[model samples]
Structure formats: C-alpha cells, structure tokens
Target: MFGNVFKGRKVLVTGHTGFKGSWLSLWLTALGAEVIGYSAYFPSTPCNFKVCGLDKHVTHVEGDIGNLNMLTNVFKKYKPEIVFHLAAQPIVRESYRNPKLTFDTNIGGTVNILECIRSTTSVKAAVIITSDKCYRNMEWVWGYKENDILGGDDPYSASKGCAEIICNSYIKSFFSDRKNLPRIATARAGNVIGGGDWAVDRIVPDSVRAFSEGKQVVIRNPNATRPWQHVLEPLSGYLWLAAHLLNSPRLHGEAFNFGPDHKVDKSVAELLTDFSAYWSGKAKCKLVNKRDNRKESMLLKLSCDKALNLLDWSATLPFEDTIRFTAEWYTSYYRGKKGMFDYSMAQIKDYTNKALETNNAWARGVFND
Candidate 1:
C-alpha cells in the first residue's frame, strides 16, 4: 500500500480511459495523488472509466502515445514524478486484423514513452506494463519466470516482447547512468479480468454481452489454460515496484512477473462457470471446433517468485473472489444500480481492507486516512 509515498505526488498514467487504467486512476486519487491521463479514447462503451467517473478525478487528455510531440507536451505540462505506461494495442485477435498498428503502438509507443522520459527531468520512477505473453511461451505446464525466453507467436505477444526489449535498450543506451533521469522498470502480468471490460474477443466481456442478450457464449479454446487474476493484482505490483524503484536504483532496468498462485490456473470454461455461479445467471458455453489462424498459447503461466522475494508483493485475491468481484460488478451495473462509483470504491476499499487486515504486504498502508 504505499499511500504515503503517492500522496500529493504528480503521477501520469497512459491508457487511463481503459479498464485497468481507470481502476488505477481511481486508486491513485484515493491515495491523494495528483493524477493525469493521456490516451486516445475509451475503447469500449460500457468501460470502467465512465462507470467509475474517473474523468472527474483525473485531468484526462486525449492523445496518442506514438506522438512524441504530444507526449512531450503532456510531460512538460504535468511534470509528473512517476509514470505508468499502459497504452498499447492490447487485443491479440485485433492485432491479427491490424498487425501494423499493434507493432507500432506496442513497440514504437514504448519508444516514445522512453524518449519523453529521457528528455524530462521531474520523473523519478516509471513502470512500463507488458503482458505475460512476453515469454516465448513453450506451452509448458509450469510457470514462466521473468528470466524466461522473450518470444511470442502472435503479433500482439511479439509486439509486447519487442516492447520489453525496447525498454531495456533505452535503459542501456540512454538511461543507464543518468542521475537526473527516472528509473525505468517493466511489469508482466497474467490474464487480467475485471468489471466494465466490454472489449470484443475477451472472454468475460464477450460472455457478459451474450448473457446480457439472453444468448449462450461461444469460446474458441475452452481447454486452453491461463493464469487468470483480477486487474488489481498486477496494478498493485506495478505501484509497489515503482515505489521501490524510487529508492532502489538497482531495481531499474529489471522486470518482474505478477501472477496468481499456481494452483489457481484454470481453463477458459472454468472461469465462465464461476462467473455464472456468482451471478445466478444461466451461462452456457457453446464450444466450437473452429479456430482462428492467429495462435494463442494453449498453456501459459507466470511465476511471481521474483516479485514476492524482491518487492514483497503477492496476489491477495483468490481465484473465486476474482470471478465473484467481476460478476457482481457487471450484474450491479446492468441492474441499474445507483452507486456504480461508490460500489467500485467500496470494492477497492474492501480488497485493500482484507489485504491489510490479513497483513498482506501490498495492502499494508495503501488506504487513505
């Protein structure tokens, strides 16, 4: 929880209009930080940014991360002390439709962020978010560590892998010994599912859309196993990593993987089943034999030993709670609940409360007074 560390500090978040970014923006505000966001637009209609009224809390700027001039202007205006770079073409299926955009955004956009950080002087810490797919996934049964091979079969995954490399390159080439420059680090996370994510091709959103329409959900790969966790899981890691990097410059240029417990790895169908049980809705999955030419790993997992050992971070939310929290959120929103913003804040409070009460390292002091 490092609420004291962020209080009154200027923090910049790219992709703040998105699901994960919105939640993080709200969290940073609750921590008493002055937050600013720069992204093109909200990718989905019923996204968490609008659901939680994040725009009211953050100075939301509409811009592209690939535009160096635009990003430099934002850096100059905000003069942020810390940065969270989440802007990217995230969807794997969508990347197949437009691989060029994916490569440019993920790889080139990272270069742009590094360029701005290189030129700026107020920044003390920066966390660049990449996917667990950054690993050259061997479809192994065990989990992939941060030191694992960097490779991917799909454009989205490969682009993230390249982004990781680009961050490291920027560090060695420019930021390695710059005393005034910000310390840069990268975070890799597992499949993150949460409320208000209506992106196409994503399992939860696709299922929610179907169930809302009174139709069954269709999944391309029911048996494919993934290390699924709530969005807050990795966000917590990123926040903690950034806080630590501010003090420990040795952590700069390093990477960490934040993922759920190994025992919680479940197939695609298992997750949807849990969602149905939580919502008390008739959720049936219509598994089809058809497959997209784009290849996703059949079995993917991440080992967070490095994070736990180094940053003292862990996944506090269990597998069932992850599903329940997501389902309850969508159910409340669709049922015309009055306290969308309040309920979301309450969930954040509840999660943090549980973590702190249980003495979880990540939530120890994140709650505001």
Candidate 2:
C-alpha cells in the first residue's frame, strides 16, 4: 500500500529507537525510503529497535534532539527531503517524576528540530508528532477538535502541548507563506497499543510485563477512558499526512488528529479484559490511592474528520482486532515462534494492504452500489 510514496526519498525520523519510531522506521525502509534516524540511545535496555533489527537497516545516529549542533550536522549530512519528529519524554508517570527533563526533551526538542529544518534547504515536508493530550483537556464529554485551546494537566501532557505551541510558532514566524520553504504539519493521535513496544507505564507494555511474568497486570486507572488504536493505525495516518503535505501546501500550518471511530472508544478495564482474553492471562488492577490528585482527563477523544476527508485515511481495524493483533505478536514472540520477525513484518504488510483495499473499496462502492 505504501507503493511509491517514499521511493528514493530521504526521510529523517527522530526517536527511531522508541516504540512508534521503531515501527515507523521499519515501514519507511520497506517503502524504499533512505532513512536517517536521530535520537537519544534506547530508552530501555531491551529496546524494540534492537529486537526488530532496525538499527542494521537505517542510518541511525545516536544523539540528543536537544543538541542543536548534532541535529544541524545530521541535517547537513543527510539532506533529508522529509522529516518526522517523534522525540519526546513520552511517559506520563515519569513526567511527574522529572518534569524538567520532559519539558526540555519534548518542548525544547521540538524547537530544536524546527530550527534544524529552518537551517536546511532541501527538506520539503515536515510532520511534528504531538499527543492527543496536547488539547486543553477540560475533563469534558466532547471529543477534541483541532481548534481546541491547547493545555496540559501533567508534566508530560503539558510538554506535549508546549511542543504544539512550538510547532505553531515556527510555522508562523518562519515557514508559513514562505515560498520554497518546507510544508509543516502537526499530528495528534490517541493511546496507541502495538507489538514490540516495551515502554514502562504504558498500558499495553505494562500488560505485557504482567502477562509474561504470569501475574495480574496492574492498571493505574481502571475506569479511565481513552481513544485507543493500534500503533499502525496512527502510523498510517502520519504517512498519509506526510505524503499529502509533499504535494499540498494547503494542508500545512494545520493540526490533524488521527484516531479510531467512536464506537471503538474504550475504558481501561475493558481494554484489560480484552487483553486477558487475547493472551490467555488473568487481568486485575486496583484503583490507585495516590494523594496527588492532579486531575487526569478521564475521557479524551479526537475528531479525525479532517484526516479522513483530506488525507483519505481511516482506522481500518476495529478495537478488538487491534488488541488481538497486538497480543498475538507478543505471544508469538515469547513462545519462540518461528519467523517472529518475518511474522511481524507480514502482519504490518497484511494490515496496511487490507486497510488501503478497504478504503478504496468503500470509495468505489459509493458510486457503483
């Protein structure tokens, strides 16, 4: 389904060793993109990038996104045509522990990437990846629109919100309306669950941690609801946005939310139940009794109509299938299944192709039926 979107293109993906970054790197490589990755070392010991053999495939540079000199050097050397900035302190709980690092990495790193892009001449399209939490989460019932006021409750969320502001500032101060300048867009997506992600404090990885050890997975907020989708779902949207931005400058200077259909909206306990079923494990969690009742948005969803209408993309797999595929991958990997890498690659290819086929089929059916 990637087809020739990335043929012979130099794509720079930050945070390539992280969970989403590892998946994006593999997808870009498969699509024939000459990929250069710049980010800090693997956040954890057993990183997804190492496990998936991604380092061998891409030209990975071990450096900090906060280091502008290193970033500038990489930009001058690689001369990337497209850029995907995903570097950040992604953990919410850890953000509480280390707010300063979160701001430096998330907010400062975003500004650093923009400055690097501004200095470079060859880059054409830039996609800054933010989080759904970037929206001024008001603890309301309605889904977040792109125009919603930006705010954050916790350090991680606030940093992401600040990153969005940085993106907007860069676009306004320099990139916007500048001829021959790169088209820049910011993307916000929901809680993503997928295979090969081993990040701490994340729901899927936490579930994997407990399930693999034959213990009950601890859920921090059992009733908290989030807009959950497979990792590939949002990656598909990001790729679509990147491709669209390459040809459509009208799409620049805008923020788009990529997420699943509303029917797939789920609570933490419901997700754990599905996880237990898919992986054959007992799932249980206690309601947290922490005193720092720094309010967390119980229900945060995004309206992805812009992405659907403009980019011609939608989440193909339902929430059940998303969880099932994720659990299956981890199960197969832990069980020493033959062709684990091959199997995971096959899953990506199969799911991506199927989504494209479904979307095209729906479009064709609109007139034929």
Candidate 3:
C-alpha cells in the first residue's frame, strides 16, 4: 500500500523496535522509503525487532523520546518528510504498576515529538497514534465518534487521552497557522493482537506465555468486550491517513478511530476459543470471582465513519482471518519457521500486498472525485 506513496520519502518512525513499529518499518522498506528510526530500546524481553531482525533494515537510533535535544537533533539530521509517533507505555495493567512512567512516556513523549517538529521545521506530515482507551470509559454500548469526550480511568488509557489533548493543543497553539509545518493527526486503535508480542499483562501475550510454558492462562474478565482487530487493520488506517494528510492537510488534521466493523466484535473468551481451535492446546481459563478492579472498560467501541468519509480509509481485515493468521504465526514460529524474523517479514509482505490491492480498489472509487 505504501510502495507508491513512500517511494524516496524520508520517513522517521518513533518506536521502531516495537511490534507495530517493526511492522511499519518493514512496510516502509518494502515501499522503498529511506527509514530513520528514533526511540529507546525495545520495551520487552524477546524484543520484537531483535526477534524479527528489523534493526538491520532501519537506521536504528537508541534514544528516549522525552529528550528534546536528542529528538531535535534527529529531526534536524533526518529532515523527515513524514513521521509516525507510536512510542508509549501501551499496556493497561502495566500502567497500574508504573503510572508515572506511563504518563511521562505517553503524554510527555508526545509533547517532545511536537516540540521537536516545531523547532526542526523539516517535517511535512505526522500521525500521532493514541488508543481507543482515550475515550472516557462510560461502559456504554454506543460507539465513540471523533468528537466524543476524551478521558480514561487507568494510567495507560489516561495517558493516551492526555496525548490526544496534546495533539489538539499543539495543533491549535502552534501548527494550526504554520502552513509550512507538518500537518498533524491522531489515530486511535483498539486491542491489537498479533505475533511477536511477548509482553506480560496483555491477553494474547498472556495466552502465549501460558501455552508456551505448559500452564493455563488466567482470565481476568472474559466478558469484557472492546473493539478487537488485527494490528494491520489500524496500521493500514494510519498509513492511509498519513498519506492523505500529506496531500490535504485541512481535511485530515483531526482525530480518527480505526478498527474492525461490528461483525468483528467478540468477547475475550470468544477470541481465546478461536486461538485454541487453531493450535488445539491444553490451556484453560477461569473467571476471577473477586472484585478485581483493573479499570478496564467493560465495553468500548469506535465509529470509523468519519475516517471513511474524510480519509477514505476502512478496516479491510476480518476477525477470523486475524485470529487464524495470529495463531498460525505463533505455531509456525514455534515449529522453527526459519527464524521469527523471516516469518514477520513474510507476514508483512503478504498483508501489505493484500491491503494495497484492497485500498487501491477502494481509492479508485472513493477518491475518484
């Protein structure tokens, strides 16, 4: 999808060693873009980028996003034409343990990115990735729109919510009238499940951890339902939105949510069941009876109509395919699929081709005007 859009473009990716970051880095390389990576070390054991050998493909710079001087130096050096900000403390349960770090990384790091952009004056487009948890957890059944109130209960979620505010505030206070500055937009995606995510405290990772260790995973809230989609679903939306904003700033400098449609909705148990069906593992899960108040919303949904109308973006992957592909990835990797690095690169190649075909068809019809 990005092969044509990013050819010869100088793109800087924050969180280049992260799960989504690794995938995006590979995609940009496939598209023939000169990629510069800026972020701290990989955030977890069995690091996603190292496992996938992504460092060899990117200009890896190990640094903190909170350091203004370092980030500004990178901006000045790379002179990036587009930026994707995905660095953050992304886990809710982990947030409960490290609230301060979460806030500092998510919110403060965002400020640093925008500040660097303001000072460097070379960037042309930027996409700040937040989360669906940015929405105030009302525990309602309705889907959140771009204009809905932004807030959160947990540190991770609240930090993302604060990041959203930062995006808007910076846009209004600094970049709104600076036509030469990069156009900025924020993207909110939900619980993204895929391979190479070995982080503790997340459902998919927890499940993998258990199954790989011959132990059953623990179920905290089997009934809690949030918009679940494959990682590529939102990444596609982000890439498309970035490309659109690169061309037309006025129509794209707002917030957008990207996730599977209503047909993809499933309970936690349902997702696990799908995974188990693929692997046929001897894993089990029991509901926690105690009042385990983790601050996760029981129900969170988002409407992508605004994105569809404005950026001509949509979620093209189905839930079953997501689950099957995810399970198959782990299965193949465990069975020694010529290293996890090639496996991840192969998945990226396949998914990017599929998304390119799908989006090109959609663009022909949607952007024909």
Cα RMSD (angstroms) for every candidate in the order listed? 2.4, 3.0, 2.1
TM-scores for every predicted model: 0.96, 0.93, 0.94
How does candidate 1 score on lDDT? 0.86
Q: Write the per-residue lDDT of candidate 3 for residues 1-369, one digit (tens) a residue.
A: 432577899999999888788878877886688999887887787777887787787799989988888988898888999999998888888899889989999999999998987887678889999999898978777789989998988899889999999889999888876455578899999788888787777888888778777787887788878678878778877777777666565654588888888777788878888887765656666656343677577788888888777766777677888887688887786666767767776876676566667764333323412
After best superposition, candidate 2 residue 355: deviation in angstroms?
A: 0.7
| Local distance difference test, each candidate | 0.86, 0.83, 0.80
Candidate 2 per-residue lDDT, tens place, 262-318, comes to 888898888878877866545545555343366466788888887777666678898
Q: What ranges in model 3 sit over 4 Å off?
A: 289-291, 353-369
Error of 2 at 275 (Å): 0.9
Clashes of each: 2, 0, 0
Which candidate's TM-score is highest? 1
Query: What would the per-residue lDDT of candidate 1 be over residues 1-369, giving only the tens digit for each residue?
Result: 664689999999999988888888888988899999999888898778888887788999999988999999999988999999999999998888999999999998999999999898899999999999998978788889888899988999999999999998999998888454589999999589988788888999999988887788889888888989988788888888888777667688999999999877998878877887755556766976665545676889888898878777788888988988888889999888976788888888888886786676767743211
State the RMSD for candidate 3. Answer: 2.1
Question: C-alpha displacement of 340 in model 2, angstroms?
Answer: 3.7
| Higher-lDDT candidate of 1 and 3 | 1
Instruction: Find the 10 residues in a row with the least total lDDT in model 3.
Output: 360-369
